[model samples]
Target: MLIFYYSKGSSALAAHILLEEAGANYEARHVALAQQEHMDPGYLAVNPKGRIPALETRDGFLSENPAILTYIAQTHPEAGMLPDTPYEAARVHAFNAYLSSTVHVAFAHFQKGARWTDDQAAIETMRAKVPVNLAEAAKLIEDHYFKGPWVMGDRYTIADPYLFLLHRWMEKAGTEFAPFEKLAAHVAAMRERSAVLRALEAHEIS
Candidate 1:
């Protein structure tokens, strides 16, 4: 059995969604961020970095959203989490890269500024800078990234969960994502999925 340690509605939601989609033999354990359970000794033992979304597998603990999501998709090919062709696969990965690195970093600056610096003024400055950078990221996703109804067009892939998580984060960060019509449509489509709905419930997101 796979033991997934996650924080409610964190980036880990993508992995949880994938697991639900794949119908894998796994269990979800919530690490309450509000209580700082993620940094506790027991949780730290599972992930030395003290991060949520650590997956304990037979091989050991697998961390990082991209790696965990890719592993689940590959392991359960019948779930069709990834596309068939190599080019399409690359496209999916390309989207994931931008979301995880660029877009995610931009979103993090607002609330996670402490990770960057100890200075309160500097942190506030970073928080203030979020809207501008987030708007750019949103525009990028609206124009080139979201191909309409989905990240990769009509078909839902691993990228959907990854992208949808960003939508959630953007909303939580107080950004007006409705301006990105395509992305908003994608969010609507995502909400209808059984896996996505179940993931929301599993994490008590609603």
Candidate 2:
């Protein structure tokens, strides 16, 4: 069984949802970020980076959503979490990479600005830019990346959960999604999934 450590409402939700979708035997261990338990000595021992969503596998621990999500998908091939074709699989990877590197990073600047700077003014500036940054990301995903219905057209892969997580973040940041009709519809469809509901309930997130 895998030991999954995560904080509620964080990007960890993506991996949590995927685990449910795969019907994997894993323990969801909550590392409360509000209490700063993630930075505690015991938690750090599991993930030295002190980041949420660390997975303890037979080999060792793995961090990062992209890596963990892929691991789960590959391990449980029967779940069909990843695409079969190499080119299509690479496309999924590319989309996930953008969410991790660009979209997630932009969202982080809103809540984790202190990680980048000590100046209060600079932190506020970063926070202020979050709406614009996320709006741009939403547009890019809508126009270029999103393939509709599911992230990769009819099939629901690991990318769907990641996109769902991002959509959640955008809502929290007070960014409007009215302009992106497809994204709005996508979030609605995701909400109907049993896996998403299970993950949300487990995470205590509405």
Candidate 3:
């Protein structure tokens, strides 16, 4: 598997963590977002959307961080990165939905050219909305969402890596994620995991 990702981006980080946790054999190719490498004709040919975190699997090229994580978990059940029960699986999926739809999209609004010329108004709007949405997401995760140490209870699932990735971004944005104590603790715990640590070190991110 070849993962085309941006080292500085959260989506790519999520995929990287999942790949490590799943103990999957893969190669990482960095697409420098700073240089608009994602939009290069060569990269665009692999992913029409010119997005990072695009995975080239034996089956085909897959995009989107959530889909890539799910594929890894499903393909490597021995890794136990996905819930076994149907309802548990649904909950994990819900967390991914919240991260992708709410958290990630809100962050995108602040990205270059995401809105009208990155105006001060547009940038501030995104900055304001992101904290509110992140706090809400943290609350939801703390209550009746994940079970134990990680998302999906005692067992660590793909959701944990995604959450960790997002939380790191939120911190960088000056969002006080401390409002959700459990969620914050959860992230810390995930960071302590050997697999997670290995992944971070491999990426030279932490």
TM-score of each: 0.94, 0.98, 0.89
Off-target runs (Cα >4 Å) in candidate 3 are 2-4, 116-120
Models ranked on TM-score: 2, 1, 3
Model 1 RMSD, rounded to 1 decimal:
1.3
Model 1 alpha-carbon drift over 4 Å, by segment: none
Best by lDDT: 2
Tens-place lDDT per residue, model 1, 66-180, is 8888889998999888899999999899888888888888888887999999999999998887877777888987877778777888787889899887677777677778888
Candidate 2 lands at a TM-score of 0.98
Model 2 spans > 4 angstroms off: none
Q: Residue-wise lDDT of candidate 3 within 142-171, one digit each (tens)? A: 886757677776788888888887677677
Tens-digit lDDT track of model 2 for 2-79: 999988888999999999999999998999999999999999999999999899999999999899999999999999
10 residues in a row with least lDDT, candidate 2: 164-173
**lDDT value for candidate 1?**
0.86
Q: Choose 1 or 3, whichever is better by lDDT.
A: 1
